[model samples]
Target: MKTYLQAFDLWEIVNVGIEPPMLRPNPTLAQMRQHNEECAKKTQGDVLPTKQCFRHDLYKNHGL
Candidate 1:
């Protein structure tokens, strides 16, 4: 019983102590250029540049 409990603890530690790194997809050059153009068009008429505006534009177009 004691050995079983130790094994359980070790299992818990191994499972919980480390997390796998998250992977993200990299955009291609054309996709990046398109995104930049979209952002520019969205923000073109604005007098001040802001992150909120850029993000809003991005989300408005991309639904993200």
Candidate 2:
């Protein structure tokens, strides 16, 4: 296998696969406020937040 380079100069100012950026451009403050308001209107605080799947649940029901 070809090993990756260890030099730091060429990578000090680059976007690469090894350490990709964490975030991108987000909506403006006004847009975000509008979206949050719309979501709240639809859910009305009655819906409970949930994760897609839990680690324990997956292990318990592995073959189902």
- Which is the leading candidate under TM-score? 1
The digit string of per-residue lDDT tens for model 1 on 1-64 reads 3233233333233546754232347978887667556535533433244446777999999999
Candidate 1 CA-lDDT value: 0.50
Off by over 4 Å in 2: 1-24, 45-64
Q: What is candidate 2's TM-score against the reference?
A: 0.30
- Work out the TM-score per prediction: 0.32, 0.30
Worst 10 residues of 1 by lDDT: 2-11
Residue 55 lDDT (model 2) = 46
Candidate 2 residue 27 Cα shift, in angstroms, is: 0.7
